[model samples]
Target: MSATPSWQAADGCVHTGPLLQSVNGFDVVACEACGFSHTLPLPTPQELEHIYSHEYYTQEKPLYIERYLEDKAWWDEVYAERYERLEAELPAGRRRLLDIGSGPGLFLAAGRERGWNVMGVEPSERASSYSREVLKLDVRSMFLNEETAPTLGQFDVVNLGEVLEHLPDPAGMLRLVHGLLAPGGMLVALVPNDFNPFQRVLNESMGVAPWWVAPPHHLNYFDTDTLPRLVQRCGFEVRHVETTFPIDLFLLMGHNYIGNDTLGRQAHAMRKTLEMNLRAGGETGRALKSRLHRAFAGLGLGREVLAFARKIDDSPSPA
Candidate 1:
């Protein structure tokens, strides 16, 4: 586990708090300097490469692809909302997008179907292969690093969904994305909102173990505040922030899904049902849900956070 007295985060913030919790034998600590939390002894580059390229889909989560296929309709709805939001900010005829860690290339496909120029970079061999062979999407089977970033060219929007938490140096990744973005381009980063009030309530008040803290897979933890701060520090102007449905509310309401697969499925089903029903109600229903979720985001209560930022234009001022 390599437990240490203090650890320096990628953003130059040092974390010195005592161990917050240990999950799967890895120690986690909170960074008072940056209001972030992460695991100790981050994995090496080689280890990360092997894990993602080989073991991630095959060994770590064998049924991920199947489950994703099952929820394809719902996934499309989620992607549509994001695309609509980002497109609203863009001028007419500018819809180039690059999705990092684009698992199975579904997001890219959705964007392309919406008449947007889309590309993806995914490290997982199985997932990337599926994206290419099955989905016929333009997904590169490699990680997004300095060497590869330049070749990808500029993008109007960069999407990083559930990606930063898995990295050892998230700031470095964002910096690369900054360079890849066209002037005034947007960056959409979606990550799980951890260590929030709801999660603390579930862990402390309820008998739920810290189920969200999955080490080796998720090395960094971020809430809405910390995530925006990180993105802004990387030379982006934070535009909008919102959260998805707080699934933990089910647990809070006596539907204990912790450690029970059946209850967990039921809870997820109910949540999806509510969202699907609201979405079926057309524009009014969509607006209502958006307002409700925005309120939840303001309170920092959600299962996941979606932040939209724009690359700060650095053009020289005319004399």
Candidate 2:
């Protein structure tokens, strides 16, 4: 722990909290007001624009798109689960969806397959182009902001998967989303569950660096507890919060994949196999697997947190 730094949030709140760790010269500290940790000295908006728009998929994470396609089967299953949750919450006829930071648009494509009017907002030109030209999906190649949001119109559900953690102002982004949704519209937000108990065990016992503290890319670090609170603060009523498998358990078990890409792939494959096997093992196995994941979430011991929330009815009418 080091000296806490004074930081200001998007909502004008000042935070000077305990230092968590430093990565790439960026200090991550818990926000005294928001209760979540974020990288200090936030990257400028222009820096973020250049990074995500041009370099994210091409340079920073070159294998991201390829790996996504490689694991298409599992990814489809994951997307299906999200849609099932959204469908369960929304009315039968309500199938309009807007996926913020839609990435390669596989999730939107999945929604379209299920009869939903799906649209996406992605900043990356390469990803957006692939979604439109190759996948033939309607996607806007721009960041979601005040100007861009008004043009997309309203949606019955807004899926913010793996998007919030990258933003400099997560709560502000959610407030924008609150206005984009119809009354009682669902919001499916998925983020990496950093600083969980499993991660602590790995860091303390195994003496591993805080590998998840990625700067310039992941500015905010959130867990199940902090995420739900942030969503509620942005005018949404949380309905459910569940977590995915705790993959860090493998790292604790001596399969250290910190810098080893081959080992990392193996660990990911093992996790996928566990879930896919349960899914393929008939209805009873699927039910059991779902229950197991819920239990993990309850204990706050998962690799990712998937929260479902609905816009509070008292929200202003969409413009």
Question: Judged by TM-score, which candidate is best?
Answer: 2
By summed lDDT, the worst window of 10 consecutive residues in model 2 runs over 310-319
Top candidate, metric lDDT: 2
Candidate 1 per-residue C-alpha lDDT over 88-163 given as tens digits, one digit per residue, 9 for 90 to 100: 9999688899999999888999999999998999999889999999999999999999898999988999999999
lDDT of 2 by residue, 202-245 (tens): 78887888889899899999998999998887888899999999
Name the lDDT value of residue 121 in candidate 2: 92
RMSD to true structure for each model, in Å: 3.3, 2.1
Task: Give TM-scores for every candidate, taking all chains together and pairing residue i with residue i.
Answer: 0.93, 0.95
Off by over 4 Å in 2: 8-12, 315-319
Worst 10 residues of 1 by lDDT: 1-10
